[model samples]
Target: MRRAAPLALLAALGAAPLAAQDSAPCGGDFGTFLQGVEAEAVASGIDPATASAFVAGLGPDPEVIAADRRQGVFQLDFLTFSRRLISQDRIDRGRAMADRHATTFDRIEAEYGVPRGVLLAFWAFETDYGAVQGDFGTLDALATLAHDCRRPELFRPQLVAAAELFAMGEIDHATTGAWAGEIGQVQMLPADILENGRDGDGDGRIDLKGSAPDALMSGGAMLQALGWRADEPWLVEVTVPDGLDWASTGLNHPRPVANWAAAGVAARDGALPGGGPGTGLEARLLLPQGRNGPAFLAYPNFDVYFEWNQSFVYVTTAAYFATRLMGAPIYLAGDPDPGLSGEQMIALQEKLVARGHDVGGVDGILGERTREAVQVEQQRLGLPADAWPTPALLGAL
Candidate 1:
């Protein structure tokens, strides 16, 4: 759910030769780089023998580097990505995994105060419960990104951490794969493995390779660190008034239920949950598909879910999947803005820019800023200011 910055996308687009050029700073000599990294690892408390063995004869993986360069295309509309990621197959697999690992999951939940269903949801979403944890070398991926000029400042430290992991004998050069240099069942980065990885199975090493216990426990620890509240719902379906002030609901904004109810918002069914009208738990009303699709009142824990992955669709899908694993219903409605396609969306951005609106960039993606601009344009055109982009709106522009 990591939201790539525009700079990251730009780097991805311009990566091939630039990545090669950036590697020159390390002198096009993998052996020297390995030696230097080993020296640093020893200085940072790694054993000399372990460092030597781990950093021996490693080279840049061109395949992994090329894959990094092509990550720009992975960005998709939130709902689209969610629908594919949280499919029925994944849900059924998660439920089965939950049942298979019931004892381990129960222990993790009791210890970490995270629900088993939520843990299973992350398990299913991240690496399919340890079934398909990519096939790239972690050291190669981190080193390539670190050597690349795009975000060396960010990835270099991770490279150092990857070296340290090697020195610890936690992972070898051969058995590692992750898009952003993460590894194992939960797709944890090297730094995360170093800091938060736990020996849940008590087998001496905290191996996320095939250990469900290690993966689930480590994921629970990460979520706990991100401020996940025990036993609190991340989000609940809600119904908003037809004439509600849609502009008031933005990311991180809070509105009490009393205030929302006064404005004619209500629970999707009949009544609110156990919490009082003014329970002091501030919530944000989100209309992801403008006002025409299903609505949700997101709680603080929902933001915690976002920390795991920044995409709204990702968090919502995780929450929804968790609910499903707990016997809750699927979403009552579908995406409202079904007409918007990538090319059409990009065209809309071009038209918006032509009209003197600064939409950040002419990317096809409709982020919060783009949605706001679309809303403004809709108002100016005497159309519904629901912020839902359409082909008709594009032609009119």
Candidate 2:
């Protein structure tokens, strides 16, 4: 499915096609920032009074800025991320939670066709099954992000959406959530809530924070709206045969399940997750850790996780944990390569760019562009184009 960057809607801020926002240019003058936000709100037809009150009352959350600065996804390895995220305790708890909420999940699947495992995994990971949604006020966190120019283009629309929500009584200034103004059990961004948030509990109000039914139903609704398929498994862990075509793995290399079986890809349990006898479902190979780590057959539904969060570690972990909720084992590879530091990743990205590939601006992050570029470089060198970065590739590059 076509997707925007997670959390924030960047296009609605200024019709001027603003450049990528990565600088914190929101100088200490809070009043000036409010004036600009006020002007944008007025132009966007948001209630001026609601916008002014929110902007006027918003306080600078230095802790939010500090937390943003410390988030370093580029430096994480798959094993580390998975180990930290999917503990045995968490899996057991998730299984229990799934059983407890089976009725609701079944209802959602009967209606929306999106699986309960997917929703359950996100619930566990995003907010620990609603036990820890967040502690910051939504308005305060949103104001901090929108007022700060580092991501104003992204958060500005969120601010406008918040104003509209407030005017309509969807949220209040005291509504608390993540530092980025994400609320609800799933930590949904403001814009998505405005678009797909629903009243699942029949309460006449959408209370994502306090109501599990509302959160799951709305989450299911959003997934279906984005084209979630009932019959497809988002991803499945599998054992790729010895010396399999390593270069032939990636989201770009989709093939039929029959073709994958012919080419030596087998599900961990000898039966594919979404494939029955002669199911002929399509999937692609995902080698997140080059040829040495565990492999997966990712389907179209896998891309939707990126809709929730673009971080590979995050989306993959969510998928993995969901599978575990179905009794899948840990990885077959059993280990991940000790990964890169942020500076090292930046150097790798720079090298990839110098070799005439667009790795999305040398941002130290190994997003899709960087992974694809690495695939090209690997093919050029006649190595397995696993599309995963390695210390060896960094040195060679």
lDDT of 2 by residue, 233-290 (tens): 8888887887788777887788887778888888877687645557667888887787
TM-score result, candidate 1: 0.81
| Model 1 global lDDT (CA atoms, 0 to 1) | 0.69
**Worst 10-residue stretch by lDDT in candidate 1?**
3-12
lDDT of 2 at 181: 80
TM-scores of the candidates are 0.81, 0.87
TM-score of 2: 0.87
Which parts of model 2 are misplaced by more than 4 Å? 1-23, 26-29, 273-280, 334-339, 361-363
- The whole-model lDDT of each prediction reads 0.69, 0.74
Top model by TM-score, which number? 2
Among the numbered candidates, top lDDT falls to 2
